[model samples]
Target chain A: MIARNNVVEFRTDLPGYPWQIAAGDGETWIILRHKARLPVTQIAQLKNITMKDFNWRIFTKALSKTLFQGTVSLTVQYSEAQHHGEELPRETWVDEHLARESFIKDETVTGKNIVRKDSRVKTAFSSILLDKNMLNTGNESPSEGEGIWHLELPWQAWLYGTGKHQNPQVEKVHIAQVGLNTLLLEILIQLTANNELDLLNTQLLEYGLLPREELIFKIEGQEIEQILGVTVQRVFHQPVYDLESKKLQLRNFKEVDIIFISAEKGGERILTASRLMEEMQVIPFWPRDWKRPVDFGLFNKWLGLVKVAADQILFQGDYLWFVRSIEEMGTEKITALEEKRKNTLVAALPPPRKKPGEKWLKKDKKEQPQSSISKKAITVRF
Target chain B: MVWQFSSAGYMRGQEARRPEVLPQANPEALPEVTVEGLPPQVLSSYELKIKSAERKSPNSWLLNTSQGEYLLRELPDQSNQAKTIELYLQFSEQGIANLFPLEKTKSGKAYEKTEGKLYYLTHYRKGNFFKGDDISHLRLAAKNLAILHRQTGGWRKEQGKKQNLWLTVKQNRLRDLLAYLHYLKQNKVLTDFERLFIENFDFFYDQGQESLEHMVLAGQEEAFIINNLLPENITLLDDKLVFLDITKWNTGPQAMDFSLLLNSYLPLHRWDLDLIKDLITQYHQENPLDQKARHLLLAQLRFPRRYWLYSHQYFSGQLSSDELTPKLKRYILECYWRDICLDQLENWLIGEWDKNDSKE
Candidate 1:
């Protein structure tokens, strides 16, 4: 009789969704509803793993009894494509160091005009992998592009510790508010179905690359209005105290913005706008002499820059924001901002009181005021 | 000031709500605790009959007489009886429902040291222990915690010294695990199973360290925390929730206490977002949390505690698959849902507290 523990069921309710397992059924084919991809260079590369092949007993025995709330009795069975195939496409092993050098060369197309577009993903992946503490650093090779193992993007970002990113303090705050991993998994599951792997993967990849930074260069809403030649009403407004200045200021924050400019030919024009961090805006660049609606070819060029430079970009409405780190910055200012916010919150709270019969509360000395000035929401123009 | 409840129609002999509530035995089934050296006045001229006895945890008994029921509790050590009495009295004063030690002994003491054993007697209240799945019960537990913390604020301030009481123990355990894994490898005693555990240690340790750093950054300690806020320790009465074990209370961040409750309950519900939101909202409504406190709670939840704990046990050669496997399964399941829950909880908190945004 089968142990019943070996039986496994997979929930592929969401495409590109990681597996949610439960123990049931004696027959051992765990179906993948979304066509879970395996980089199958050849059929011979496939490795069929059965319950007897590994310690299915340990995992099933562990997961079944308590968490899934019942006994999981089954023999585990699964197959995956591996690197070395028995027959066709036999590849020679090359030195990884040499391959890395070649990749760098390929990354720069010709004559100092780096192939920035093609190498952007590699760069982002490399930056994330270089951090020794990130969980991804151990499993993923920075230089390797195609692999048997691929982590869906924002999930990948989470495994790479949030603090290891370009803006640690902001990411730290962000991670605390909505844990990166859970937020992404839940949102992705809700937004996509089993057949939408391609869309889900693309969205995940894009959203995972977006980052949050304090000194950001956004085309101020009014400036965007001037460029698009339209009067726009802000829907979401907040009174934010800017970290740099001590004045309170009202600002509009949008998760995503797409501006449509009428082309001379008179159709529809689409220009995606994303915030670029101040430090990365080394060269003043913007689309110029672009006809409305903007040419698709030209827009793609602008989108490339947005993809690489922006820490966070909202690609579509109600979809996840792309979060990534382009350049590492000193976190001193961010840390100071965090401390100030906490102190402000503490100050706003009602003072601690002594319970009746607890005389010590009355005897306590008053807390000392913070020496640092509170940051203003509005920055003074120089 | 405690209100009495009638035990009628209460299903008196059924298993109490918690798993920790041992099966109740008949009153005559067990031998009575020796009251040999205790002053006669402590019993107050009533014949005390044992209603229930628990030998495993804190060694206590439920006693009933013609007047009313009383709980006779035994202390682990005679020296700490005074401290226990003091804490219970403070808890009672703060509107926390606790069995305050009765001041009936001849010496006007809350506890009596008889024949080198320490014991305290208090009026027992009838209540059902809390179940992890009871949403209302969970909400009440969190609200009661906030109230308890608010009341204990003054006491927390008096004990001004800061202590990372478990830091040394955890750090030492991590170091020992590393050494043990190395020794196993060097001696050719490592199995494939052991190798898998060894491979995962770095990631788990690093994850644990990252969370610990976040806690240090948040500096969240403020209220007197009940170190063990397990669901079993909370009981639901007709009108109020009563705390069972008061012996493990300590001074620390309320996050530490709340996180323990959340962790315990998360697995029970398989990390249901609606339930988690309800629990956190109830707690926040009672005790408002600022940015720092929220982050501290997240940090506590985010810590790779199960990994560190089991790895420590494995290194100590104390890990049995029966216990560790189920916990690991629950950990994985909760981790899968952690981020989603944290995000919603944060948004709810920010939406509530962001007065300027709401006004705009």
Candidate 2:
């Protein structure tokens, strides 16, 4: 048995059988020929241990459960014999140079290091042939000289040390008016809840390297597992001021420190920051009290009554009710005023008692007979 | 104070006569008209006897003739009319079946000039307006637009003119926005719409500026584009999508059409990024876009075109405060979702470029 990292090589001494290797979380067994030599009995025992001890289903189920923690598990079934003659020559120049530059200690460096540090390991793995038919174990029709292998492991395990899984710390310091920042935060929270932060984290890692003026996420037709890929360094929430306030305090006013990850790399940060400030400035300073209308029961009742009255006037032509409402409110005061005027008039002029057939008009004319003549004389003088 | 007083007066008037409570007259009623005033020579040229005529708009007439229904339109500008007729003929020659072909007169001319006005006839097309609810319809429209773009790619070259107003348009929008801001500042008392505009002014102004910057960054690749892809301009005729109007076609980046289509359809879908991605993918599948074209598309989408349009209309007196207020409110709501979509699209585009770089 030859063990290196997660891969273990076993020499099958059976005449026609080739050497077998267990790799990738011990879920896959590959048949191949390697330089390592081992006893025939030990190789056979190792093969039995690989095939009999490992439970693929239980291992996969456990890995799937960990997917919510930003780990992706994939089961890849491939074969090596189909690509036996087509394998490209492995290039070891770069790896050898790097290994030579580093200090090699006998105590730390072993056969495992030699295999792991060599580029031939990757080249060998890359030669593992895969086709549509080979992907399905039940329908795999192996051609002549083909060796079938099942490789099941979390695809993201290789990226463990690459810093691709690190999620950006999105801190919302001050958000005004529940606008874009709030919406973005909500989306992030949702993505995290759905266990889709893996894709987001990976995209954000890429985004941090190449930041644009605007970090736009295409949400149209995005699958459930796809990420929004927005890299917000820090969100600085500031107060929304009206245009007048902003203009008045232009000199003294301090802008929000909105640090978009891309802003660090580009010279357009000032423009972006100022734009954010302007966005804040234009947001009308809604008074805290005015966040929601005061829900007054009396006011609501009055509004309802007014609405009903309006409906009646417009649709039913019911003006009588409206007039009656006004009259009812002023009825007592009007009656009292009328009574007082009646008393004053009665007291000023003596009440005249006329016979049933007497003409009140003729009496009035007789009393003011000279009045008409005076009026006519005054008119003539003018 | 003046705005408040006006509002109070409007409220009183509204109370006195509620429009919703009152019975409304049918606005679709077509006025009956006789063909007595129509030019006899023009009718003879078309070789048709008009049975009845009804004015569809100020310059268009729906005529029932011996040969099926036709739209008799009065072309206002002779030069533009000629160019339009030429384009129509070109389109027909290219086998674009979406556009309606003009009926030829007896002399084999597209138009007939009688008195001072030039008139043209086209067979009336019947179809339902594009409501943008179905994905299949959107995909079809996108694919058709791609085909149209491919055919019109060399239109500017053939015409021997470079009508690239991409930057000019952004400059004008920015200018209008500044003017609008000045107008708002000059007002002693601001209405609700004016106040809202002032509140949201900076954000949109920033967007306008960014769009200009993007236009500059997006290299010049001129192609004839349909500038107006409004829902009203598109009609679904059977399984195919037909463009009802093509007069607004101009030479610009192919992305302009994509932007216009998004502007028309995004709001209807509540600015779904998935829908936009699907649309772009469909279009890209038909006519592949380069890096510059994609950048231009992004730049066009980033601009607050609708916001600028509404404010411009209000400031220009095309729309009153009452008409603009509700539109502004609805627009503000749309911006909330639209901003999210824009952010998502930008990130996606950057990712795409990164992938391409890695591949290279």
Q: Determine which window of 10 residues in candidate 2 chain B has minimal summed lDDT.
A: B1-10
iRMSD (1 decimal) for each model: 24.4, 34.4
What's each prediction's TM-score?
Answer: 0.42, 0.42
Tens digit of per-residue lDDT, candidate 1, span A100-138: 122222221121221111111110000010111221212
* Residue-by-residue lDDT tens digits, candidate 2, A1-382: 0011221111112211122221111111122221211111111011000111111111122321222112111122222222222121121112222222221211222122211111110100111212212222234444443322322221111111111223312111110111111100000110111212222111221111111112112111111121112111112323323444431111112122111111111011111111111211121233334222211000000000111120111111101000001123378887887676654321233334456876554565457444322321111110
**lDDT of model 1, residue A205:** 17
Deviation of model 2 at A117, angstroms: 77
TM-score for chain A, prediction 2: 0.19
The TM-scores, chain A only, for the candidates as listed are 0.15, 0.19
